[model samples]
Target: MEIFMETPTAANGGNPGKKKRSWKKLLLWLFLLILLFSLVFHFTSSLLFRKTEAGHLKFITPTVAQFRHEIAVRGDISSSENQDIKCRVRSTGGVMITWVVDEGTEVKEGDTIAVLDNSTLIDSLDAQQIKVAQSEAEVKAAENNLLTAKIAKEEYENGSYKVNLQKLVSAQIKAKEERDRLAEYLQHSKILYEKGFVTQSQLEADIFSLKQAELTLRAAELDIYVLKEYTHNKQTNNYESDIKTADANLSSKKSVHLQNETKLKDIQQQIEYCTVKSPSDGKVLYVNETNRFGSSEFLVCQGAMVRERQTFLRLPNSNKLQVTADIHEGKISYVKVGQSVQVHTDATGDKIIQGTVIKVDENPQPTNHWMGNVKEYRVTIRLENPEGVLPGMTAETKILVEESQDEKLMIPTHSVFEHGGKYYCIEKKPDGTLTPITVELGHSNDKMVIVTSGGLTEKTQLVAAAFENRELISLPELAAGETSSPTIRPKNEEISGDFNGENSNSSSPQAGMKPDGEMGSDGPKFGAGEMGQNTGMPGEIPAGMNGMRPGGPRPGGLRPGGMRPGGPRPEMDKMEQNGEMSAGMGENGFPPGMDGMTPDGPKPGMGMRPGRPRP
Candidate 1:
C-alpha cells in the first residue's frame, strides 16, 4: 500500500515535465514557420521587382530653362491689287462664240479682245423693222378717218341749212304767183259767165291747184326749222365722237411705232457690244481652274458658252507682292494684325522675305477631305521686298507666335495630366511613396509646358506620365498567374466569394477561379470556336461556360462541385487533364494559327509542354 501511493505522486510530477517539453516544441515550430514565410516573401518581392523600364517609374527632375515657340504654316504668293475682265452684254437670245483674243495677250485701253456671233440679234432686228412699217400704215388710216369726219361736220354747220332756207323761199314765191294767176283766171271766168265765155268747173280746178302750191311752200319752211334744232345736235354729236375716236386710234398707232423703233435701237446697241474692249492696260495671265476632283480644265475658251457676266481675264500686279498663309485654327490665336512674318519661296532661291500680317480672316476656311479636316484661317502677309516672287508660287511662312528667355521652369508636356478640371502630377519622394501634387500650367509649345505654380523646385522629381502610377507592384503580382490553385485554409480562417467567383471558403470545393473569368488570359476564349459568352449552347444554363446561373449556386450554372455535380470544376487549373488541354486553353497556350500573332511575341508554334504550363 505504501509503494502504490509514492508511484502515483511520481507519475503526476513526470506529467508536468512532458507537458512543458511539448509546449516548447510547438513554439519552436511556429517561430520557424513565421521566419520561413517572411524570407520567402522578401525573396519573391525582390526577384519580381527587377529593374525593368516598366518597374522603374519614370521620374524627371525639373530644370530652369528657356522656351521659344513657333508655328509652321504653308502659303502662296498672290497679288494684292488685281483686275478682272468680264463679258458685258444684255441679250435675251444666248450669245454664240465668234472670235476671242488668245490668252496672255497684252491689251491696252479700248482694244478689242473678244467678239460674239450677232446672227441671233440681227434676226430679231429684222422682225422689229416689219412691225414698225405696219404701225405706220395704221397711223395713216386713222388720219384719213379724222379728215372725213371733220369735212362732214363743216358741211352741216355752214352750207346745208342755208341752201334749205333758200329752197323754201323760192317755193313760197311760186305759190304766190300761182295764186295770182288763179285769181286772174277766176275774175275772167266771172266776166265770161256774164258772156258765157268760160265754165264754173274750170275756175274751181284752178283754185285747188293754187291751194296745193301753198302747202308745198309751208312744208319746205318747216324743214329749215327741223334742220336747225334736231338735225344740228345729232349730226354734231356724231361728228365729234368720230373725230375723238380717230385721234385716239392715231395716238395708239404712233405709240406702237415708237416702241418698235426703241426695240430696234436696243438691238443695234447690243450688236455694237459684240466687240469686246479692255477697260485698262495690263499684262494678261491665263487662268486654268482646278475642278472638284483636282483635275485642271479650261473654263474660258473660244467655243465655251459664256454667260452674261463672267470674268475670263485677270491682270495681276506682281510688283507689289504678298503671300496668303493658311494658319491652322489651333495656332491662329497667337497671330495678330501688324505682326512681323517671315516668308520663303522655292522660286526665289528660298530667300527670306520680311513681311507683316496685314489681315487675319475671322471665319475658318472651308475644309476638304484632302486637307484632313484641319481648320485654318486665311492670313494675308504683305511683303516688303518680293525679289523675284511671282503669283501662283508656293511659299512657306513662319509666324513668331511667342518667345521667352526669362528662364521658366518647364517640363515635357507628357509629364502632366488634368483631373477634375485641375492639372495634377505625381511627385515621388525619397521613401518611394507617390504624392499627388497640384500645378498650374502656363504657355506651352509642342514639346514642353511651363509650370507657373507648384511646390516644385529644380531638384524635385515627378512622374513623367499618369500611367507611371500604375507601374507599382500590385496584389495581382502576388497571385501572379491566370490560373488559380486550391489552397487549404486554417479552421479559424474564413474566405469570401467575389463577384468574379474568386476567393471563397476552403470548405467549398469550387473556391477560387481565374481573375476576370474569361476563357484565358493569353489563350483562346471557350474554345477554337470563340463562342459568345451569352449563348453557351441555348437553354442549358452552363454555369462555368457563360457565367449564367439559373437555379444554381454560382455563375455559368456551376454547382458546388463543378460543371457536372461531382466532376472537375470549370476553372483554369483543371483546363488540362494529364496531358490533354481544353481547346480554349491550348496545350501550347496560344490559339492555333492566330493571324494577329506579332513577330516579337509568341509565334505560330508556341504553347505548353508536358508537365509545364504555357510560358
Candidate 2:
C-alpha cells in the first residue's frame, strides 16, 4: 500500500519559516501513515494464518430476549407400561420356536401369538407315562405282598393255632384215659394180691404201670403249654415284621408313583406352554433375537431355541406414552425429575410435544466400549397428548434445566469468547478502536446467549468475531461456553442401529424372528427341529433309564443303576510301610528327594512309598 502526498516545493524555497512549517507537516503525515501500516500488517498476518480475527470482523449490538437454559438430548418413544411376553417353558436344553406372529402385528388379548415345537416335550411325556405305569406296578406288587402277609398272619393265628390246640387236647384226653385204665388195672391187681389167690409181685407191677402213665400225661401237658407260649408267639412276630416290610415297600413305591405323576403333569404343562399367547391386547413387538452371549443376531427366526423366561414379545400400552432419552454425562447433572421438556420427532413433522422429566437415572446406560468411559444417563419423559406415537420412534428432546424470566441482554451465539475462566467481548469504541470487555455469562440457547454482567448495553457495538491480537485461551471459550458433540443432523432410527454396537446387546427371544430358517450361530445350533445329542428312541427317557436321575446313582456306567460302587480298601493308617523306594522312584525317597530314609520304612506322612500314605 502506498500513500499520496503533494510536494511542498513552493513553500520550501520561499522562506525558512515556511519551509520549517512544511517539513513539520510532512513529518506529521509520515507518523500517521506508519501507524496505519502497522495496524494493516497485523491484520494481514492474522488473515494469512487464519487466526482468531482479521480485517473481516463485523460488529453487532446486544438485544434483549427471554433466556431459557435447556439441555438437548435424543431418544426413542416407548410404552410406559410394556408387557413383555417371555418364554415360559423350562428345559435343561432350551426349546425350539416353531411359529410366531409377525412383528408389529396388532392383536387382541388371548391371541395365539406363537407356537413352539413340542416334539421333545411330548416324547418326555410318553416316557413319563411309562414311568408312571412302572411305579404303579411296583405299588400294586407291594400291596399284594402286604395283603398276603396279613392273610397269612390271620390264618396262622386262627386256623393253624386252633388245629394245633385241638390236636393237643386229643392227646391229653388219651393220656388221661390210659392213666385211668392203668389205675383200674392196678386196683384189680391189688385186690387179687390181697386175696390168697393174688400175688404181691403182680400188684407192685400194676402200681409202677400207673405211675408211668401219669408221667406220660404230664409230658403231653407240658408240650401244649410250650407250643402256645413260644411257637405261636414267634409266628405272630414274624408275620408282623413281614407286614411292616411290605408296608414300607408300598410307601416307597407310592412316592415314586407320585413323582412320576408330577413329572407327567409338568411335561403336560410344558406342552401347553409351547403355544405362546399374548396376555394383553396391543401391537406385538418382537424381541431382538440374541445369541447365547446375549449379542443381537441379525438372523433370528423360527426354530430359534429360547431359554426359559427369555422375553419374546412386548405389548406396548400406547395410550400411556413416554420417551426414554440418553443424556450425555457432562449435561446429565442439569436434568432432574419433574422438569419441563419439549420433544420433537420427524414422525410428528416438527410438531412439539409438551412433557415433563419424570426420571433422571442415576446410573448410566450400557455404552459401546468405543464411547470411552463416558456414562449416558437414561432420562425418562412423560409426554402430554402423545396419542399417535409408538415405540422405537426417535425423539429429539430439550429439557428445561434452568430459566431466567427477566429481560436479559443477549447476543448471537458466535459473538462471545472465553479466556482464563472469563468471557470477553470486543467492543468497538467511538474512537474507532476495538478493545476487549470482560462479561459475565448466563442462560443461552442454540442461537443466542445471555449477558449478565459487564457494562455492555443495548446499543453498544461489539465485534461479531474475535479478530487479530485477540484469541481465546481455551476450546470451550470459542463456542460460547457450550460443549456440543460433533454430529450429523436429523438422526433417525435407521442410522442408530449401530448405536451401542461396540457393546454386545443380546435381544430377547421374540424380537427379531426373521423367517423360518434363520438363526444365530449359537441360537438353535440344531436346524429344522433337529435336536443335538438328544434324539433318542421312542418311549426311552431322554436323560436317564427307568426315570433314574442322570449323573448320579452310578457314574462309572453310561446308564443309571448299571454300575456298582467301588470296593473298600485298607485304611491309610493300616497300610504297611515299604522299606524300599517305590517302583519308578529313586532309591532315596518315593519322590526321589529324601533325607529321612536310612534303609528303613518311610515315616508317616513322609514322601510317598509303596503301601504308604501319600505325602
Candidate 3:
C-alpha cells in the first residue's frame, strides 16, 4: 500500500480567519470549565454549612443580664347607654319639634332639649282637669248629703222615746179600768142569784161579761209590755243601722276624693314631661324624625309625628367623654381597676392618650348576634384628657399588665438540662472536657431562664449547646456510685488526690495505732516546727493532752467523737481513728462510769473539772 502525505489547509492553521475561529472555540471551553468549577464549589459549600442539627443553638448568656419586659398600649372608646331609641307611642298628629337650643349650644341643668307638639297632650290635660273638677264637686256634694242623713237619723232616734212613753202610759190606764169593772160585775151577779130576783140566764150573762172584762184587761197589759220591748230593742237597732249607712256614705265620698287627687297628679306629671327637658348638661345631639341638626341641635319640626314619651332628641355631654371597652371573658382577669393603659384613636397617627381603668363591670355584657361568638365584659376607663377626642371615635387599645427592665440576665430556656430529677448546666473544662453542675433557678419569663444558685456567679462562661455530632458523657457512669467523688477540678496546685481532692488510696491507721508507734502527743506528730509542711490530722486534738493518749478510745463507751460534744463524728475521724482501743480497765476495758455516760458526755480528760485525774 502506498501512503500519501496531506498538506495543511487555511482553516486548520496559519490563516488569520482559521486562527480566530480556533481561539474562539478555546475561549468557550475555558468559560465552561470556570462555570463547572463554580457549580462544584457552591454545591460543596452548601452541603457543609447547612443547619442540620435538631436542637436549638444560641449564644450563652446570664439570664439576669439580658431581655427587657415589653410595654403595651391601651385604647378607649365611648358608647351609648341606650343602644336603640324607638317611638314609644303611636300617633299621626303633627309633631312640632320646638327648638329649645340650637346646635353647638351649651346647656345647663333643667335646660330644654326639645318640645314635641304638645297641643294634643294639652287638650287631653285640659279635658282631664275639667273631669277632675267635676269629680271634686260631686265628692263634696256626697259628703254634705252624708252629713244631712246623719242629722236626720239622730232626730228620729230622739223622737222615738216620746212616742214609746205615751203608748205605755195609755195602755196601763186602760188595763186598770178593765180589771176594776170585771170585779164589780162578778160581785153583782152573785148577789142577784141569792135574791132570786133575776133569771138564771141573766146571771149567766153577767158572769160571761166579767170573764170578757178580765180577758180585755190581760190583753191591754200584754200590749203595753210588747210596745215597751219593741221600742227599746227595735229603735236602738234602727239607730245603729242609720249610723252604719252614714259611715258607708263617708267612705264612698273619701274614696272618690282620693281617686280624683291621684288622677290630677298624674295629669300634671304628664304635662311636665311633655316639655322634653334635657336630663343632663349637654349639647343637643339630634332631632328625631329629621336629620337637619348638625349632631348638636334639638328641635321639634312641623309635620313630624311624635309619640307619647318618645325621645325627640338626645343630649350628650361631649366635654366629659368616657370609653367603654369590651374585654373578652378570657382576658378579664388581667384587666383590673388601676391598671395602666394607653389609647390610640383610629389608624390616624394621632397622639396616644393615657388613662386608668376606673371600673370593671361584674357581670359580662349580654351577647348579641352582632357580637361574634365571644363573651365580653364592659370595662369603663375614664380618660384624663378628653379635649379633642369626640364621642363615637374608633380607637385601638393595649393594656400593659406587666413589665420589666432591660439587660436582665437571661438564658435560652432549652440550654438547661435535667438529670436525676435535678437541673444542671453543662460547663466546659479547660482540657475540653464537659461536666454537669447543679444550679438553682429563679424567675423565668418563658423565653429566658434564671439561675438563682449553685455558685453560678455573674458572667460565668458556660456551654450554650452540646458539641455538634458528639455524644454527651453520662455523669452516673462517671461517678460509679453514690459515694463516688465529685467531678470538680480545683485550680490550686496543692490539691493532688482524686477528682474531689481526697486521698482515696491511703490505708487507714490500725486500732490505737498512730502514724508514730507510741502516742507522741494529743496533736499531729511532725519534726520540730514542721506544722505548715505536714498534712497533719485535719481535726486533731491539741498536743500534750497530758494524761490522755492520741488515737485512744473515748471515755464514753465506743462513741464516735467530734469537736462539738454531740455533733456528728468528723468524717476524717473515721479514717484516722479506725480500730482504736480503750485504755481504762473497767468492764469491756471501758473507763469507770462509761457505761452510764451518754455519747455526748465529756471524756475523762476532756477538760471537765480541771483538777480531776485524766483517763
Candidate 4:
C-alpha cells in the first residue's frame, strides 16, 4: 500500500507539468495566428489606400462654413454734386485764355477767374465807332433836307400861288374898263356922222378900237382861269412830293443809325466779357482729361484755346462725397441700387468708409479694341460720412453681393467639374476607394462654392481639383443610347465625319470613345490603316484625337473620311503626292509617308523604315 501511494503522487506531479506545457503551447499558437492576421490586414489596407491616392495629390474635407459673395474693384473718389465753371465766350474759333487763376485757389463770388485775349474786341470796337459817326452825319443831313422841303412847300402855297391869282384879276378889271370907254366913243362918233359934221374915216377908226378892246378883255379872263386851276394844282403836287421824299429819307437814315449804335454797344459788351468772373464762392478744380498713355488731353494753361461751353473748371462740394467704380459684366448682375459697400481710399489708408450704391449705369463703358472685349458698368457709391476725404483720391470698393446667415457645407470651386451637364466631385469612401458623386451647387465666388445637396456631410473628403486628375480616375459609364464625341477634319477639310455616330461604319465597338483612346503616351498608332478601337475611358475627348485630320471613306467600310480614330489613312500618301492634302504635322514635324526625308536631311528618330520609300 505505501509503494502504490508514492507512485500515484509521482503521476499527479507529471500530469500538472504536462498540463502547464499544453496551456503554454496553445497560447503561443493563438498569438502567432493573431500576428499573421494583423499583418495581412495591414498590407491589404495599405494597398487600397495607395491605389486610391495614386492619381490624387490634394484632398479636402467638406465643412460647414460661411463664404461671402463679393466683388472687388478699384475706383476714384469724387463729389456727388459739382458746380462746373464752363467757358462762356462766343468768339469764332473759340477764345484763347490770356490769364487764368491757379487751380485749388479759393475765391469769392464776382472775383475775376480768367482773362481772355481782348485785342480782337478792341479793334472791332474802333471800326464800329467810325461807322456810328458816319451814320450820325447822314441822319443830320436828312433832318436839314426835311426842313427845307417843308419851307419850300409853304412858300409856294401861300406866296407864289396867291400873288399870281391877284395879278390876273387886276388885268381882267382894266380890260373891262377899256372896252366900256371904246364903246362909248363909238356911239358918239355915230351921232356926229348923222349930223354930217364928222368924216366917214373917223367913224371907222372908233369901231376898230372897240373891237381891239373886246379881244383884250377875253385874254385877261383866260389868264385868270389858268392861274387859279392848273397852275395852283401843279405847284401843290410838287411841294407834297418833296415833303414825302424828305420824310422817307430821314426814316431810312434813322434806322441805319440805330443799327450802327446797336453794333457798337455789342462790341463794347464783348470787350467787357473778355474777363470772366466767378459765379459762386468755392475752390477751383480744373476739369482736365488724362489719355491712355498718362498724358493730359486738355490742359487749362494760358494760351490754350477753350471751346464754347466746355467745362474747364469745377467747384465741388466737399461735404457730399462719392466713389465711382467699374463692375465687370459677368458680376454686374449681383449689384443693385441701394446696396451697401465698403470703401478704402489711398489717402485715408486703412480706414473703411461706409457707402451706398446710388447709381448703376445702364450702358457699359466704351473700350478700345486692344483692351479686349470685357464690358464694365459704372457704379456710383455715395459716402455716408465724407469727412477728411478729398476728391480725386484712389479708392478700392468691396461690394457685398450676398452673405450666408447660416453655416452650410461648402467646397473649393476647383473641386467640382461638369460631366453630362451635371456637376460632380471625386468622393473618398471609408474603405479608401474613390468614386464620382453628383452634387448640387448654389451661389459661388472666386474661392468657394456652396453645396446645396448631394448627401454630403462634414466628414466627406473630395478631390481638390477634378480636371487635374481626370486621366487617372475611372469615369462613370454613359447612359443607354448616349454618344458624346468631337469631330475632326483635315486642314483643307473637304470631307467630314462625326465621332458621335454620324457616318461611322467602323466594325470596332469602341471607336472615338475617350479622347486619348489607343494613342497613348507612345504617340500616334499606324495600324495597317485599319479603323482603331479606343481603349481609354469614355465620355471625354482625349488630347490625341485633337490633331486628327478628315478623310473620305475607304475599303472595309471605313467612316466617311477613310481616316480612322487612332491615326491617319494610307490614302494620305496619294493625297500628299497630288498636293490635295496639307494637314498639320505632328510633334515629329512630318506626315507618315513623308517621314525622315526632308530637304535638310533625316529628322531625329524619324528616319524612313527599312522597307518603306519616301513619298
Evaluated with lDDT, which candidate comes out highest? 4
Off by over 4 Å in 2: 1-63, 289-300, 363-368, 412-440, 453-615
Instruction: Please give, for residues 1-615, the per-residue lDDT of candidate 3 as tens digits.
Output: 999965568665546677689999999999999999999999886545433222233336464564432223233455334222223433464355544456546677577655555567677778777877877777777677667766766766667666766776776677678768777876887787889877789888877877777787777777667766875667667767766776786687778767777867776665565566555665554444423232423344544556655665565555565677876554566677887667778643678777777888998776644443345678777766766776656666656655555554455545564433356666555554456677755544334555656776555556665333123444542110111111211111111222221222111121122222123111132211112224334335222221122333221111222112222345535633663322222332234344345454523421344334444
Candidates in order, TM-scores: namely: 0.49, 0.62, 0.41, 0.58
Can you rank all candidates by lDDT, best first? 4, 2, 1, 3
Poorly placed runs, candidate 4 (over 4 Å):
1-67, 75-80, 176-221, 289-296, 320-324, 365-374, 391-394, 408-442, 445-615
Q: Give a tens-digit lDDT track for model 2, residues 360-442.
A: 89888875555544457898899987966778688888888777777788877667754433566777778655677877766
Instruction: List model 4 lDDT by residue over 1-615, tens digit each.
Output: 455544436656646677679999999999999999999999998767658665445888777887677677888888888988887667779889899999889989999988988899899889999999999999999999999999998998888878888888899999999999999989999999999977899999999999999999999999998887888788889888988999999999999999999999988887777788888888787788767555677889899888878888788888898999987665677799988998887777788899999999999887644434446789999999888788878888888887888887888777776553367778878776678787888776656777888998888888786656544457765332222121111111112123442222221232322223322111232322322343334434332332234322222212222333324556756766775434333244355444545565533332244323334
Point out the higher-scoring one by lDDT: 2 or 3: 2
lDDT of 1 by residue, 1-615 (tens): 455544435656646677689999999999999999999998887656633433477788776887666556788777888877666666564566677778757788888877877888889889988987888888899889888888877887677756765776776677667767766776777787778766778767766766776676577667666766777778789888988888888898889888988988888887887887777786665555666456664466677555567666677777887888877554577789888887888776747888899999998777654654346789999999987777778888877766785898887766665432356666777876666677887776555677889878888888776434534423222111122122222112234444343233232233333233332221112221112323344324333343222222222222231232322245534545543443333333434444344454433332444333232
Give candidate 3 misplaced runs (Cα > 4 Å). Answer: 1-104, 116-153, 181-213, 235-239, 242-246, 278-321, 326-337, 343-353, 359-379, 385-615
lDDT of each: 0.63, 0.67, 0.52, 0.71
Which ranges in model 1 have alpha carbons more than 4 Å from their true place? 1-72, 75-83, 90-97, 133-214, 285-298, 315-326, 344-355, 365-376, 380-395, 403-615
Tell me model 4's lDDT, rounded to 2 decimals: 0.71
Better of 1 and 4 by lDDT: 4
- Clash count list over all predictions: 9, 9, 22, 9
Please give the lDDT score for candidate 2: 0.67
Tell me the lDDT of model 4 at 554: 21
Q: Clashing pairs in model 4?
A: 489-550, 490-550, 515-541, 515-542, 516-542, 551-561, 552-561, 552-562, 553-560
